[model samples]
Target: MQLPGTTLLVIDDDAAIRERVANSLEESGFNVLQAGLAADGLALLGRQRPDLVLCDLQIADMSGFELLRQITELDPDMPVIVSSAAGSMGDVVEALRLGASDYLIKPADAPVIEHAVRRSLDRASLRLENQRIRERLERVNRELELHLKELKDDQAAGRQVQLNMLPASPWNSGEYRLEHRIIPSLYLSGDFVDYFRVSDTQLGFYLADVSGHGASSAFVTVLLKFMTTRLMYEQRKQDVAGPVAFKPSDVLGHINRSLIACKLGKHVTMLGGVIDEAAQTLTYSIGGHLPLPVLFAEGEARYLQGKGRPVGLFDDASYEDHTIDLPPRFSLTLCSDGVLDCLEGTTLREKEQRLPTRVAEAGGEMRRFMERLGLDPSRPMPDDISVLVLSRNPA
Candidate 1:
């Protein structure tokens, strides 16, 4: 919007040239200010902040070069057009170096002079707009960085809380030992384990790997712990003669129903068990758990036999319970499938061969087994890796 009050100050000592330029500018809707001397022009500039200026190179009192310099110091962004004659080429170039935005020929046409003024003002407006956009982009980038840092900090705090909820490792009592170690690929793990006494002579333990990873899968692990802990508590309150309540199959069925009810769209592969030290028996169930549980004793190790569909998949899915008479002294090792990916094997059979042999060599110690596999807890893993070991130390 070019308003009538838009001002242009013309400083040309020639009476005729100054009046002609001022008349052309006034016709173009600009308020015109005429000055025949540099001092008068400088005074007008201080009195009025014109949008542009037209200066003749040979103005009197002060040189046009001096006036250009003073104009730049007053307002560097203001556009300036210098009018010069043929012999003043050198002075015109020097004026440009002194900050004139454009140049006009001495006998300048009205149209051309008006065009130069408008073009210079447009360039100045574009520069200001570009600077504003760059500053705005920088501010947005800084805000995004701050938001990302907050999310990372929250995840770290959540990871620590999950770790604190896990049962302590290398736990020992009477003739039984139970312990576990887990390394998560992310801040939180989908793998979980628990071991606790279910009766005077019965010890219960289980290892589970929830589907998926991170927060959603970790939520299922918490559910697994809660359901199992509650089942054990309720069972202990009932008659001991009643069919052992936490039998492997019953535990799997209960978990299957609860997870399906929760509608989390997630499933779990697990090995749940009850060890009867008095009867020398280990009754267990498997819900699609892999690499099966391996039993190592004396000088040998082999995978336990058990089978069933993964829990939380189907409402009618049933588990077949299996029982083995445990030797007087044995080490049972449970591993999540993530560990198999770390083995340097071309076939599943070869990786399976590595697991038991390594267990027998470690003599049921979690540390020794992990060391043999070159596992580092501090380093990030491709997937979550977990190990649960139940052993009876040699007397």
Candidate 2:
């Protein structure tokens, strides 16, 4: 069907042929322009920018092929149909190579002319639509790239904050030395650890693993730090009696209630301890942690025994404190369950059985223990891993 207001320019040296083509197109709902010379046709094209062009292969002022080339340079997508009285097969192919939309024999009927014009217009419209779709996709891709960059920047900032909250590593108080390492599966970690002087005679430390990983889990680590710090301050202030008021079980209980009150829908597995340097005793508590703490002494390593419900998950959750006489030359290692992945075992029972052996192989030193387990902190891990080693004297 001929489109309404579709303008077609007809260029032919013969005035009779030019008028006949123009009149036929106009009768079929097209607005037609007629030019008997090539120069006139090019001028009309520059001014009118018609939707399609019909040109004779031979014209008085210029070659039809040359006019087609110039039109293509001006608007490469313009559709041009070339008609000739005696066009050879070579001529038809040449016209097509010059970007003609169609080649016509001089005796073609009006219906044939109309069909060629409609087909070329439809193809041009389809091309225009495809170009529009491609432009939209490019725009969308640029926007997505920008959003991903912003997200990465935010995560980097969050990671720095978590790093700052950590206590100094390889810390020394009295004859005891404390060291810790945390490896996160992503830019942020859900595992945390800390050691600080509780009093002139006491040193306290703990390792906590929050459920889940990444940003949300990392946020919970911040809360854990705040709760522990504030609890230590409050206990020291109120007790006036002794640092014994700062017990590991009490600390865990306080954190459990606080997390439940905040309704953050998260939980933690932790192990905490208080060391009395003057009396040479270690009092510790556990909160649903796994693989238990390993105590290395006299060149032997073994897991300590303890069990409790995970914090923040149960209102009635309680922790128990267990006391042990400190061996003069000893190392106590606390690890988050993520270390289980690095352990060689087919089952939980097998992995637990192997942990103490691995600790003994590393001699309870944090660096050697990591190497013995083939754990590379720089590489990606499936979960967050944390290690806290408290040692006093060496063999």
Work out the TM-score per prediction.
0.76, 0.84
Superposed Cα deviation of residue 344, candidate 1 (Å): 0.5
Model 1, range 67-173, lDDT digits (tens) per residue?
Answer: 89999999898889988786467876898899999988879898898899888878877877887898998898899889878877877876787777688787886
- 308 Cα displacement, candidate 2 (Å): 2.5
- Colliding residue pairs in candidate 2: none
Q: Which candidate is the best by TM-score?
A: 2
Residue lDDT tens for model 2, 208-266: 99999999999999999999999999888887765547899999999999999999999
C-alpha lDDT score of every prediction, in listed order: 0.87, 0.91
**Could you tell me the lDDT of residue 339 within candidate 1?**
88
**Model 1 regions more than 4 Å off:** 1-133, 240-244, 347-349
Error (Å) of candidate 2 at residue 291 is: 2.8
